[model samples]
Target chain A: MTVFRTLAIAGLLLGYAAVTSAQSAVDEIAKYRQQLQDGNPADLWEARGEDVWKQKRGPKGVSLERCDLGLGPGVVTGAYAQLPRYFSDADRVMDLETRLVHCMVTLQGMSLADATKRPFGSGTNRSDFEALAAWITAESRGTKMNVSISHPKEAQAYRLGEKMFYFRGGPHDFACATCHGESGKRIRLQDLPNLTEKAGAQLGYTTWPAYRVSQGELRTFQWRLYDCFRQQRFPELKFTSEASIALTTFLAYNANGAAFNAPAIKR
Target chain B: MTQPRPLLLVLLFVLGGCATPTELDIAKQAHEVMRASFKETGQATLDRLNQDLAQSACSIPPSTSVNKEIAATIEKENMASIRYPADGKLLGDWKSGERIAQSGVGKQFSDDPKNASGGNCYACHQMSKQEISFGTIGPSLLGFGKLRGNSEAIQRYTYGKIWNAQAYSACSNMPRFGHNGILTEAQIKDLTALLLDPASPVNQ
Candidate 1:
């Protein structure tokens, strides 16, 4: 009886120690994120992005300065907060990257291939889209997100996105909800938020276009969805595709009242 | 991409109406959009969008239940497909099973098709007292073998459940591992041992 009691006490202490160590590891990752706030590598991308916005280099020798980001012609302040909206000119809903590509094709007379060749960056082969998204999304910092479902196409996209969130297929029989439908669930040590709920949706949506320290790249919302699809073991989501915009529309619209804050740093 | 199907035109025609549409009506449209939205890359093809009856049935809004008949049909069809090992050995090396459970690789468009897939068990369940990093989507399997004695019936249930989880419970979040060829029979046996073997950390 004495030996059994002693062993039980030891086991309890061991379990308690394991829980605290795991917690401290999570807290440390959070601390790492806070430390990265002051000198965000995303700022470097933003600086280059602003330059790309003003430079005249395409076939038409025009700058993206004239592109209307759904706010008005060349009206960029807080524009990212209202995006994944319907544009009459295109007659389809578009996310910021799709709209940016549209401007490159229409306003600058650049080939679609040239414009989207590097939607994401890799070693020394930087993406113009990343640079541009960084600057444009930065312009929306401190602004409240007010994405609208007023437009019929926007409404359709939002609804379709909602379906995609719950859609299950592929080899693993996984949905986005498989990982994110409930609060406080995680995959290994990484925290997976409940994107189905309001607070999680808002938090997940507003913090994209983040500079990932692991990959050393500023990933956009399109990239986030694209990678998510990849991880979900689905086929590659086409860059700037209607499906991408639709999913983005669902998330961005769900994040209605949260302040738009990104091109932020992340681990 | 091919032209939008006649069904899409029908959907567009309906959306053109004044009445609000049900999610079921829009589900067809969503599937169509997904089919068109993805491009084949690496081993991931457009076929991944193809939904089996169980997948489609389970994808509905959480508030609704798949009608009883359909749920029973899914479970029956899946149960019919379970294949036991030829040698009748359900357990393998639990140490190897632990390694397989730790890995989350394979089948993504970015993952090499040649590489073996991992059960990614640690991503969802607490398997050991030492590994604190586990997801809560599924129940904790710590002390799983300790709770259930290693009878032949218990071993068979563990092996078969890991092989095709959907067979026992239709619309379960657990994958149809053997059915989908995500893990080989050998890997399944290892996973079974990991859950049922007396020496396995999961039982400790």
Candidate 2:
């Protein structure tokens, strides 16, 4: 009788294990799609961003509505796809955020220091920047990235960014290569994209200005670079510094031809 | 006869020493090896070689479980370190917060020491939906505001959690944003707004 009881228990345990294993697989797939379906919270920021763009309030009493995003002045439709391009006015290459800062300062009469100090989504002051960026990025949701690296400065920034990507340091002797240079690498269950590759670069770079669920916040490319430094145990990245801009140029150039899906939702 | 006994005892002692190293001994050896492999540089002193209590505790092999009391103590200690904004305000501009969260710069040997640090929250958690590219070390935070309305309690919790994640979860891999001074109070407030603001992308 005891032998029979043990056999029954063992059989039950085996059956339970099989069922749970199958269930877990199904659950994982469902979770992946569910994450996709949630449709990123950045949409909310995009909505508010539209309002901020049209609202006229700076010292110049002008809205960003008349600002050009590469296509033409006041034409935001599909403009993000062709950003980090040469702007004749600035006489230099500028990404979306940098261009927006210029507009906020020049057109709005806001001080560059005050505008930069506020950060992306903090205070009523910088909130407009986030909203504007979100709205502008959304207009080009389906457009492909076409960053111009032909210019000397653009090319220089790209090369500098490449150098920065491989540079190693910190107590752990880690580099960006430690986490993202190689394909098929992951920490825990998450996969790390190989930013060096075209597909990886496209997937990684084109999907910035994302909303993070864990932190419950919106993040821009500049912030993304800043965080990478922190994890590497590096000192700190200044806001919109040259290094930051250079890295953006490198990533943007690599993401050429990929769809612009900024202000994305992330897990 | 006495000499033979002593010789046999010595042999046994040597044999016992040959046994595999204990966990503690292995850890010590590993630490020593790491120390030998790295050299100190500017601002990033050798002290960083030493793991804090939380890091040390978490470093233990998975085969062993942390004692509940120790885990609770660590959590309590980390929680105590969290500091709220000087003003009662918890939320700031989600737009600026987004920049801080997305930034993965700061705290590198190559970086200028004078610059401020960043939170790099996206490295672990998925806060926004629009950013197709993100890591998943922690849970996804899409629709965080939609699910949990921006209540005062939730705002405080978000601030506290970002300030010191260990306060909420004992051995969380998340960094201590406020505790480490990686982010300022204003930065934390912006992050909070990014997370909880109805108008922020995270909520949408």
Candidate with maximal DockQ: 1
| Candidate 1 Cα misplacement greater than 4 A, ranges | A1-20, B1-22
TM-score of 2: 0.53
Q: Compose the digit string of candidate 2's lDDT tens values, residues B102-135.
A: 8866656655668876677776676766654456
The per-prediction i-RMS, to one decimal, reads: 2.5, 13.0
- Lowest summed lDDT across 10 adjacent residues in model 1 chain A is found at A1-10
What is the C-alpha interface RMSD of model 2? 13.0
Q: State TM-scores per candidate.
A: 0.90, 0.53
Q: Residue by residue across B1-204, what tens digits does model 1's lDDT show?
A: 122245543443354343245756677788888888899999998888877766776785551255565667678888888899999999999999999999999899998988999999998898998887777778989999999999999998898888888788877888888988899999999999999889999988
Scored against the true structure, residue A6 in model 2 reaches a CA lDDT of 48
What lDDT would each prediction earn against the true structure?
0.84, 0.68
**Cα RMSDs, all models:** 8.0, 21.1
Query: How much is B165 displaced in model 1, in angstroms?
Result: 1.4
